[model samples]
Target: MNILIVHAHPEAQSFTTALKSTAQQSFEQQGHQVEISDLYMMKFNPVASQDDFTELNQPEYFNYALEQRNALKQNHLAADIEIEIEKVKRADLVIFTFPLYWTSVPAILKGWIDRVFVSGLFYGGKRFYNHGGMAGKKAMLCFTLGGRDYMFGENSIHGPIEQYLSPIQRGTLAYAGFEVLPPFIAYHVPYISQKDRQDILVDFEKYLKHLDELQPLKFPVLENFDEKMQPLN
Candidate 1:
């Protein structure tokens, strides 16, 4: 399988970067093709603006999604966006590697999504969830966090980690039609010892080797909803 690993971390020696490297090596050793987009190294622009398009559908009003659709149709997307979009299209699987920032993705990664997951292309109208443009593809998140596992849960201080991830996991990935896999999180990474971190890398390699065995996370099925997207009984 062709895999694209989008890595978003500023520090080269960070644990998150190690995880990204481990994923690439593990996948390649397993006979899969791999590509890495190191956002910080590439100096990826994290802002979505008129600069994203060579031309606009409506120059009078700056509606980002509308312009995205126009750009996709006109082949007018900025070169960087087109490059990332092609990467996404060619991959069978896309892994997002990042250090959790404020319970969310880094700004650069978020911008990558905004620009790459173009409107009218990735999704539009009801072409989402099970019926999104990326239906046959798959996506997974491999992120590192400073929080310990015990610090998150229904009864924990930080509440459920899933809640913090729903926007990206369900809203963005699942909503775009990719079969979203359960995330592999490296928790308390900063506080962990080098041995523990190495062990985590070993565990991660094992996880990558069994990608076929991972079940996708459940989300709203279009079949279960009425024409208006209201749930049907």
Candidate 2:
């Protein structure tokens, strides 16, 4: 199966990068086609601009070099955008790997969303379920968190982290029509031992091996993943 792994986080030696590395190695070993968009490594611009809008009749053209053209179009569309979306259309299963930041996805990954998920590409009007641009895809999240798992509890210091990422789990990916599996959360990243890190890496390999089967990530009702979640915190 074809897989798209979008990674965010600056440090190449970070636990987050380690996770991405594990995922990549796993897929390669299994002979699955995998593509990665390392947000920091790519130096993906996080801000948006007016050209992404233009006049209503201007036909919404995109150019990333503008540093503010509203969005990135060319290369990424065929690469990042098409990689996962088409993998959904042609194959099955899309996985996103990142580090949970401020209880949400890193700003650059969000920017990837804003830039790539454009009209007539991932969504459109009329048909509500499974009929739009990305109706039948499957998606999952694999992320590492800095604070202890307890810190994400209801009354903890950071509030509910799972709840915080609902926009990504529900609004963005699921809205695009990928059936989301139970998100794989790796908590307490900053506190792990070298051995512990290695173990998680091994575990990630196992996750990829199992995920190799491939399936669509979608839901059909109101309490479902897409329509019911609130926006990012």
Clashes of 2: 5
lDDT of 2 at 52: 41
Error at 136, model 1, angstroms: 0.9
Across residues 42-159, which tens digit of lDDT does each residue of candidate 2 receive? 7776655543433223335534433222222333233444443454455465677788777778788888787666654565443234544566667789998877778777899888
How far off is residue 97 in model 1, in Å? 0.5
lDDT, model 2, position 184: 69
Compute each candidate's TM-score over C-alphas. Answer: 0.95, 0.73
lDDT per model vs. reference: 0.92, 0.66
Q: What local lDDT score does residue 168 receive in model 1, on the 0 to 100 scale?
A: 98
- Write down the TM-score for model 2: 0.73
lDDT of 1 by residue, 22-51 (tens): 999999888999999999999999889999
Best by TM-score: 1
> What's the lDDT of the predicted structure labeled candidate 1?
0.92
Error of 2 at 101 (Å): 1.3
